[model samples]
Target: MDEQRKKGLEKMNEVYGWEMPNIEGDPYFDLTVDHLFGSIWTRPGLSMRDKRLLTLAAVTAQGRQDLGEVQVNAALFNEEFTEEELKEVAIFLTQYVGFPLGSGLNGTVSKVVAKRRKAAEKGAGEDKRANVNAAVKMNTGTSLDDE
Candidate 1:
């Protein structure tokens, strides 16, 4: 196994407490890692930060909050994103995507941010409702036409 695969597997077991067995004996091992994660995902053109953003978007588009949360947490751990970044992603999702997906993603992102911020003893922040409303207005180009 190359160093990155070994390290990822080890970290998965240690931090996440899950053992990922080798699907194949040896030949496929390095190939699998290289093609899937290393070659494709680690392409030099896109910065790690941009990859994280696209990943979050793909997960959000798929409406897979569980997988999305896993990636989001990883991004945070890797310093690929911050709590504010998560919020902005969710806001963008709300604007172009549908409200349901947006809300669901926002909820998951909020929980992660809150937990992480609390762990870091950072000050709490406002809820996403305000941001959502603003996004709706922006997307619709409306002033509410208050009567």
Candidate 2:
């Protein structure tokens, strides 16, 4: 793999807390890995947590609960935001984005939190990465190609 793609995959894996394979020959995936993630997300100024908050707000404003779930799962898995903090984010965004959109986000946050709690309780010794990968896959589908 090229250096930029390799760097992007590494960054993407770090951000999502999972191993993401490179999807060669797909323009969308190429742009995502080589540009969006490689260039934009790797930029120095904003922390991943800060970028996540911005992403959550943007997706929530669009009422994209499906996307919100992915973000919430990754954020929680990465320990960038606590469950309580996510709840607060839902409440905070509700004011500016309106009740419906906010409620959608709230629901997504609650669902992810509950799932993580269940996983933890179910297998105290289980690998946390497995649970997170499962959650991310469930929310995002098998791959970008599937979308």
Candidate 3:
């Protein structure tokens, strides 16, 4: 990766919670990281989460379920959206995007939601144990809800 694409890939992976795959020798993939992610996505006017939501809308409207898979997974893993809110967005998009396209996108979102929630719940349990251990050494009682 070139310097700019490397930095863009790192930041995007951080936000998405997964390393986006690079296509070796593909100029298009290079351009995606260099231009779309590095330049356009880093614009100060809109937050990353907001940009993901808008991208979801655009992808759904165009019936691009493949891209939707990545965006929805990013949104869920990043906690940019709650499951209910994501479902609501799908329903809302039905009018503008049509039922077939919106429903297609929602199917991908639902799959990612389940997977992300399962991983998060497991991590939460481990985190609670660590917090409890720390609190014990400090002689301070900590409630799970306090976090």
Q: lDDT per residue, candidate 1, 54-75, as tens digits?
A: 8778878889887676666666
**lDDT comparing candidate 1 with the true structure:** 0.61
lDDT of 1 at 52: 71
Which candidate should be chosen as best, given TM-score against the real structure? 2
Task: Tell me the tens digit of each residue's lDDT in model 3 across 14-121.
Answer: 655654554455566566667777777777998877888899899899997867766776676678987788888899998898999989877987876666577688
Per-residue lDDT of 7 in model 2: 93
Error of 2 at 60 (Å): 0.3
Q: Candidate 2, which segments miss by more than 4 Å at Cα?
A: 124-147
lDDT of 2 by residue, 64-135 (tens): 897798889889888999999999999999999999999999999999888878878887633545544554
For model 3, which pairs clash? Answer: none
Candidate that beats the other on lDDT, 1 or 3, i.e. the better one: 3
Off by over 4 Å in 3: 21-24, 117-147
* Residue 90 displacement in candidate 3 (angstroms): 0.4
Worst 10 residues of 1 by lDDT: 138-147
